[model samples]
Target: MHEPAHARVPAQPLIPAQQKVLRHSVRGQVLDALRAALVDGDLAPGEIYSGPALGERFGVSATPVREAMQQLALEGAVECLPNRGFRVLTRTARELAELAEVRALLEVPVMLRLARTVPVSAFESLRPAAAATAGAAAAGDLPRYADADRSFHGQVLALAGNDQLVQVAEELHRRAQWPLPGAARIRRADLIADAAEHSALLEALIARDLPVVESLVREHFAGNPA
Candidate 1:
């Protein structure tokens, strides 16, 4: 006897590549959402959040949420608790200063070097990212501002042709942007000033003004909190 149509037409399982792509997509979404929450102060530092709870909040399954949290843990943004959940790590003022110092150490020289050698078009290309930061700052969108800020800096460093330097500098940038418990929230004015500095720095780079570029980069790392 022949099987029924529904039984005969069995669903095709996803191939390994497709499955991997899907998993990575979901993981990336969850990670972005989690980072946005962290930046916007929606996820309080020192507060523990369970994967299932955050999954429900993000409209995904616990698997992706846990994966995102694990990545965050590796980034020093959170800590994994045995049988509990992930806690947003509270950073001290000293820790933030140190991160800023390290980032400046890694990036300032690159910016100075790129200023002398990289073409004007390369720096000009980053204008949009700089503008995005300004817009986000004006709108008080902390998450967008943070992402744009990182993108601008990363683009600047990428011109140096050192992928490792870009990665390390961006990691430090991300760590520096994390919220500190009991600390005053970064004001909109501060964000705007920081964003404006990006434009100034871009202009200096495009003009190949090494002295101005170095000063702007150093001041930026010293003053920018997010």
Candidate 2:
């Protein structure tokens, strides 16, 4: 028999050094996308996210997708499966109720301090973000509206004059987004109503009505969500 021809081998694909940087960038992008999906309710609680499918969706390899899922798991946004995959973490209705209660307690009192300390000038500064929220509500961009809604709260928090309270509220607001999907639609009416409240709070502040501001803050959270 004729000697077999030497087997030809294909050269290995070379990933350049810059590929590592690209991989990191891809990982970051994947992280942000998954986070947004979670916040927007596109990734529902208890739903499985396939690493391969996520990789395909973002036009990346599974490595970055897996990495992003792991990070989200650490944040409690998702949970890892044993030898299977990851699933979105669910917050029970009871847990949501408790969070709402805590938010009311922490944030409303903080707003009381802010309403008292916020200058009339700061009210003018808040108008634009407030307007953006109103516009988003009109346009039916619930996520943008949520952002604007949160921004309005942030402006109030900033005026509280307590750096630590502001920081804690800011962080809690981020986590709060997870439970806000259903509330987003409810907030269409809420934003309009809240705009009025914000205006009223400012007016009360200008008038130095501490009781009125406290009442408004309490009312705001009390009616937030069940």
Candidate 3:
């Protein structure tokens, strides 16, 4: 069956499952890179990026980059420009405020409920995630800080034992973090202050201080601008 050495298949070939896994791995890596670029302002708002160009930048095929851009479009981070490409959207303060309101409506009550019933040990366990945000902020690493921030919140909400709620809340959280055009750059001091609130909220949760938790939660959402 080996008509020519050059035409012969490799001794070990990737199975269908393995191929799918490899594809997913590449797609995930591309997606993370795109998200990091967005957070770092490397992909500026209102910029138009084609899949091929992004693929060249990330050293992958256009497929994964386009897939990642599609996901970003679904998350409201970008707008699909028909046959052209994707345009990074500039988030408005009003849009961000609306998102904050929705997140507050969903999470505040759940957090308060969990504070009253969940064990203090559960809150204690999330301290490391909370601390990670502070470290990321200290380094002025916005992408890392964003990830740590989301992880900290996700961990806190996962205590409710509702996967659907966690997914929806996280989606909203990501949308709120998108960059705004003409807005002042986020200062490291501001990031540090915001990161500190995570620990403060955790402390209130551990203490079972309902009023303090509610106040902190509301203020946290209010102070955040998109």
Candidate 4:
């Protein structure tokens, strides 16, 4: 992603309180936090990130920081430099479009099949994911909203019983998450509409309406119908 015109480093980097380590939080938890930070724009795209600095922010040693970043690199979220650290990598517009196409091809089929096969009762447990998405959207919390978006979609796809499929779909989803042009200027209406779609999609699924489910899935990419 291109740097925003007004981009400037903050006066102070985030420093998580050491006392906040409540109960030996694992590396996965740290990874989740870092991922959320990226989605929330707490970590700017195109910025260089050092493991030690991030370690300080997370109140942990550099090892876990590096490890977590390594995982992100594998997922194409960041690129590591030998002597330096990692650079956040956002897909170009064309690249994101291609990914969206591929994602729709893969995601839509599974969704359609599940709509016809899975009982509506099986989806009752997914209410929380949908609710979280609505809550995040209503509050305009991008990180929380993005994570909930993933949860709702992932849960929907899990009926396929393919862990690898979910992982790949998630990678593509993350790539499409870079801030749009004038991201800070995004309107409340857009966010509300985006969040509301989750509930609509869920209702479509529960109703076993394959056609509506397919359309909703395609529109999840927003204006890029597959």
Candidate 4: where is the Cα deviation over 4 Å? 1-26, 180-187, 223-226
lDDT of 2 by residue, 93-191 (tens): 666566556777887666666556667787677777667766866665555655676777777777766778766765555565675434343445655
lDDT of each: 0.82, 0.64, 0.81, 0.73
Residue 40 Cα positional deviation in candidate 4, in Å, after optimal superposition: 1.9
- TM, every model: 0.88, 0.70, 0.88, 0.82
Alpha-carbon RMSD to native, per candidate: 10.5, 10.6, 9.5, 4.3
Question: Model 3: per-residue lDDT, tens digit, 1-226?
Answer: 3111111112222223234457788888778877877776777787787777666655567798899989998888888887677888897889889988999999999999999999999999999999999999999888898898889999999999999999999999888887777666688998999999999999999999999999998888888532
Model 4, 1-226: lDDT tens per residue?
A: 5422213322232335445553335467667777876665666667778777777666677777788889888877778987678887755668777877998999989999888888887777788888887887788777777788887888888888999999988888876776543346345466678878888988998999989999998888755211
Best by lDDT: 1
Q: What is the full ranking by lDDT, best candidate first?
A: 1, 3, 4, 2
> Candidate 3: global Cα-lDDT?
0.81
Off by over 4 Å in 1: 1-21
Cα displacement (angstroms), candidate 4, residue 88, comes to: 1.2
Clashes per candidate, residues 3 or more apart or on different chains: 0, 0, 0, 0
Alpha-carbon runs more than 4 Å astray in model 3: 1-21
